[model samples]
Target: MAKNNSRNMSDQSSMNGYIKSICDIMRRDNTKGAMEYIPELTWMMFLRILDEKEEDEHLQSEAVGEIFEPSLKYPYRWRDWGSPEGKKRKELQEGHMDDFLNFVNDDLIPHLKSFEEKTNATKRQKIISQIFRNLTHTRLGSEKNLLDVLDKVDHLTSENIDDTHQFPLSQIYEGLLLKMGEKNNDGGQFFTPREVIRAMIRAVKPDVKHNGEYATFYDPGCGTGGFLAENYTYLTTPEISDLKLNASDYNHLKHDGFWGLDNSFTAFPIALANLVLHGIDQPHIGLKNTLSGRETYMDLFEGAPYKFDYIFTNPPFGGKEGDDSKANFAFKTGNTQILFIQHIIDHLAEDGTCAMVIDEGVLFRTNENAFLQTKRKLLDECNLWCILSLPQNVFVNAGAGVKTNLLFFTKGETTEKVWYYDMSDFKVLKKNPLTINKFDDFLMRLHSDKEEDKISEKSWYVDIDTIKKKDYDIKAVNPNIKEKEIPKPDELIKIIEESQVKINESLQKLKELT
Candidate 1:
């Protein structure tokens, strides 16, 4: 029967079931009713999964064998199950799973009448009992059934679980992404283009060899954890064509490497859910403003003396005007992008590499807004490795066609020449509707690690001294020029001849009518 049901039900149906189960809880609670508010749902689902896992014979047996038994007496079991005061107590203790379960199941459910007179909402009390009863009816199947589902979930063999679960989670995240995009929060800053993200990740290429013995990864502006998740995906090899499962080392890395920080109360939970859903066990996520100069926020880097081996991000840009008063201490300038760049540079390990997407204004602006100084500092202090000029219409869906560039750099070495790849003419990425087209060739070129072929039309290297002389203006050094030009008289005569032919035709038509 289970096999038949599993076979008949589509993946969409199963996803809907999960979503409906969540919605039912939300409707009852009257909390923010969107799934994108993932923190609330994440906490609930974590408890639900724990309860389900506890009830499983296989997991329970394993739990007994493991160092610690599942905390059965605390969080998993519902409290006040059969009590008259159940409803009143349930609301007060909704999120406090451990204490509520212990008190209600062990004490109140057994001695319900004693508490009934003290509780408010007698009808709600009755409803609460019924809800608990209903909850018990919802079964996640036996141990064997769960194991089968887990097997499918664990089918990814890539080092990054993000790619493995990207399909399933993308369906979940798209709804949230669209909602966040619509809100226009932080100047529509929450949304980061995936192709651009992929490009950054591809450029950095964080791997075991590059990261050292125990490399740490972090993203201070970890929106929905897209940067972290993409980094995770790139590190892992995709499932082989003939292989049954996608291959990955994400779990191993997460246990040792991954960490993130975000300030958005809304985005924090989504980021956590993203990491967990991607199979990172106990993701080390924290909530703090990356732009905060406070010692408490900066203390996150205390233990990790060295900077990250590789960092990739698309920090919020052009939202600096509203809250410039309390910007980071490291940021002497008013520009938010420059501040973030400074922060990234400060946190970087001496040997670390980084790639960041920034507004085009950061490149060419010669004003005294500290923009030129910041540019000078970047060139002088770090190895300004490469800059890829991304195409316009890349972020059209977000209602911005402003040109952007991918700035790649490293901490220790001073760069002599900066590689410049003009992807301005590159086609847009299809899945990313915001962008015109993805520059797969650019990524391929980076991956190949080859030097410039002077003959190649789209790419070349520029001297740092020349860029510095130009005040770091890295626009199109070479533009496509037409081989020939039409003379003015000839062009005018051609236009006149076309107009005369049209007039002649009109006259002949008039004659016919007469």
Candidate 2:
């Protein structure tokens, strides 16, 4: 991981250029966009890194007089087939592109995918098998281009990179993940911005090891593992963490601290590879539909606790669930976020805290039974502490234009009052993306104990009594903002008639001139 760390901008630029070059090569053969080439690149990169890591671990075990069993064996590992001078590559021979592609598509992939079928598969073996399960064949249209790709990935080693100023592979993979989310047009389910994720993590920095034991941090709908990844970075970075975490703490945080579930096959493997590159050796992510109770893969999430100590997530907005998903919950609603709210309330520990990105509609629209009951349950069960109304176009870069809000609350207490911060009046543009600096004032007031200090032109608290009086429509309406006066309907119609008469007079004058 240190080999991928960057010391300056030039190193990052070099890696960016390198990755772009690889994409360009893949584009020559297939250009259906990143949906086609990114997955191909992901498996290659994963195997390459995995092989190297196991090699190092093997050496370390040998030094300690321990026998090591590798996750991969001879003629199947990257060095045996992916490299140009590899044994399998030599057997296929140069100029026999058909033979090479056939071996990979027919033999190597199937062998790798078989690891999960074994009754006694090791944890690493299971992870490897799952990562390669989706790779049925090579996406590269040209066998020659495929060889070029393998050679490029083969040369990607720590010694080949400028170690003093190399770009982190984790950050590089993140850039790739952004490409998958950019302008994704499937119902405007935009990926959560990392800046927003970082702010949320800092706002509720849960102890990685809760109650002197391993604490679980979960995301119900983790997209590419952004929230979990940022939380790891926050806890590990020295300047950010006040506690002096030792080696054992770091080990616990890496293996047992971060857990997530994503329903996307496209994103599931990418999330695994991304977390591994970020130094999370054991990412407990499940490839299952969290709401529908359907699973493609949950082998990695075999021992998840019934509840979690902390939950940080952005549930899919503007989506609906079927009866299958709604049936398991206390509140039966098609609203995706609403059902997720119910699920969170059930799964959160008694002392758990959650920071979720939600649709603004949930705060208002007192029109349905499910909506009203869900909000009532949240208020009665949890201390609904704060709601920050985000700007309308905050998701413009990710191709969504809906209004969003951040909800922060803790379980085991009824809400007495709720503090609200209004960032809705500010304009959010693609050129000026929302940054963490925008939350300085919000964070400052959030930490203050005095009620008077939290009141401002853009911040105020609403008592529970007032919230109930309004039927629980807790939308942030700025009191300091003045209402604009409007003319009556008849006056507006008269003004339009006067404008039409002026237009007719102007047209008559033009006719006279002609």
Candidate 3:
């Protein structure tokens, strides 16, 4: 999808202002927190976008002399309940506001919820039913506020500006997710920064056309489907256009190429809405704790290790998988990261590639049997190709202080050599966040031969013999940067004396005051 329209700051601000107005309505209505506002806003946006798309498709069908079978009945359609010219809006303005809200509460939602019961429902209908099933209109205050919010939503067009390349609904949706994570109370646990998602996608380079089969990507711990969405864009971009894919190829790719799982009750709908707004008519995101094993989607994975062609994710950290989930893995670890690592290895296709972020503890913790066994299996079964020690500030907004590394590897090849890139010194702040350009040199080096790939003092490689002797610890230690020497006791005393005079002067001044 080539974007011929270019969006300037003014267009973005106008749309953002609209979003801000919606949030203001929610806040005024006492919608409680970001948790409430996010879901509320997402569902509203989903309906609005869906209606616009349906109308366009219906017109096209009519133009081609085909009957447009609408997914919703006339009374349940967005134009019926959501548009300004609709009966509901006219009644809402004329003091039948409660009647309109009652219809939405008692009638509209129930109709939407019935999609799951239809034996012949399409994937899109099922997805709609799943989202509404998990959703509730909690703490939405008053009908007046709802009408006000609906009016603001009605102002949004599918495409903002036609000539100047204004932001589309997709960008608006992405921005809202970012806002939910950044300014809302959610702490964005389900949202990985876009920069990190793109980097992981670039590293894995998943291609449906090149694979000669129905290529797929999975994120076992998909928080709001960031990795999966980024991967979808990668496969459809013009850079991969040389494959000469037609419309049906893309249609297949959009519906089947992505799979995601998450345990969050809150994240499921958000992820579904995110994917739907991004033109994935039927997203394959399911609700499951990647490690929980509590519920199953036998239809999708066939009750076995459903291997995907590529696996890319940033699994939740600073938590532990419970005993029941731990029982499912060979390593038998309570650690969440380790269990996800094992799960990915088991479910990755024979030639599958995976790029994930892991806590630094997984790289150096040799005390636990589970950890050691994980490292052993990773080394023996896969070629662990690269490690990038990321700067801590990269995840500071997520409250992550533990040093993390990006691990890229493929199955069915024993490790021979591993490239290490030390980016600890790379400064990143919230205001000056990491960007795709920052990883340009690293990505270039990633594809080149070892001899030609050297970038600076931060890049190096460790052979398999060295790794084996070190017991498979893959932490990057830059050989090029010389270590600093510690001072002797006498030198330490001299350093203390240098600061003692100022300390004594301050103490004496305090004594005089006393």
Tens-place lDDT digits, model 1, residues 183-256: 33442466676767876776676664453455667776787777876666556534411112222344456554
- Tell me how far the alpha carbon of residue 445 in candidate 2 is from the true structure, in angstroms, after superposition: 2.6
Steric clashes per prediction: 20, 2, 3
Per-model TM-score on C-alpha atoms: 0.66, 0.90, 0.90
| lDDT, residue 459, model 1 | 69
Query: What overall lDDT goes with each candidate model?
Result: 0.55, 0.82, 0.76
Q: What lDDT score is found at residue 477 in candidate 3?
A: 83
- Candidate 1 weakest lDDT stretch, 10 residues: 1-10
Worst 10 residues of 3 by lDDT: 1-10
What is the per-residue lDDT of model 3 for residues 1-514, given as tens digits with 9 covering 90 to 100? 1122334324666767668778888999877566678788887888887888888889999999999887776777777788778875576557654777777787888878788788887667777776787654434658878878877777666444332332266667777777656633464677777887787777766677435777777889887777877776666665532355578778876677778888777788788888887777767877777787765332333333378888998877777778889889998888998888899899888878999988888898887888888988998899999999888756653565677889999998998988888888877776767888888888878877767666578898899889878876778888988889999999999999989988999999999999
Provide the RMSD of all predictions against the true structure, rounded to 1 decimal.
10.4, 3.4, 3.9
Candidate 2, residues 1-514: lDDT per residue as tens digits?
A: 2143333333656767777878889999865577777778888988888888888999999999999999889888888888877887888866464888888888989998898899888878887787777788889867789999887776667665655422256666776666765665332243677878887877787776776677788998987788888788777776775767789888987788888898887778777877787778888989998998898899999899889999999998778899999889887889999999998999998889999998898889789888888999999999999999988876644335578899999999999999999999877676777888988888888888987879999998899999999988988888888898798999999999999999999999999999
